[model samples]
Target: MHSIATPKLTASMLALALLLAGCATSPDFGETLETRSEQASAIAGDYKKGEKLIEAGRKDVREGRKLARKGENRVNRGEDRIREGEAMMAAARAAYCRDTGYATPECR
Candidate 1:
């Protein structure tokens, strides 16, 4: 009985040793941690750059809106000026017809 138990104990000890050895030979945790740290830093840098770009885009949009409003105002003022000029021309044609008694093409 003693001889049989000795062999079983030795086999169990050998199996445990092999299992521990396999675990020890696996990938090094220190190297994996370092690689993950580098990847995280790169991601953080990209995120910061993206934030800056978004802010710049927002600024551009704001400036564009301001320019569009200015353009609209100019267009409105130009239209008003055109109406004033038309009224002035009409008045001049009426006066010319009254004074000369001549129905020129413009007076018509």
Candidate 2:
């Protein structure tokens, strides 16, 4: 009777130890799921910020191109005015030389 009792008591103790060990090592499912959800939210926020920056950059480029075209048109108009002024000066010099019967240094 003593030998039979010892074997049964030993088996019961072994089973209890295994149950405690399993509880100690088990993962907390709720905390793991929450952590993953927060990480995904952060990634989505970063993507939105990047998209906004890209759109702003595109808008800046468009405005810069418009300003450059305006500047080029202004320069062309100034050049045309300069050419007209030179032709008027030449005509005035030629008329002065023809009427005075003397060539000035500038007219020559």
Best by the TM-score measure: 1
Query: Per-residue lDDT for 40-93 in model 1, tens only?
Result: 455555666776898999999999999999999999999999999999998998
lDDT of 2 by residue, 1-108 (tens): 468545643333544544454445546635453454454455555655776898999999999999999999999999999999999988898888888776667656
lDDT of model number 1 = 0.69
Model 1 Cα shift for residue 74 (angstroms) = 1.0
> Which window of ten consecutive residues has the lowest lDDT sum in model 1?
8-17
Go through the candidates in order and give each one's C-alpha lDDT: 0.69, 0.68
For all predictions, the C-alpha RMSD in Å is 20.4, 22.5
TM-score of 1: 0.62
Candidate of highest lDDT: 1
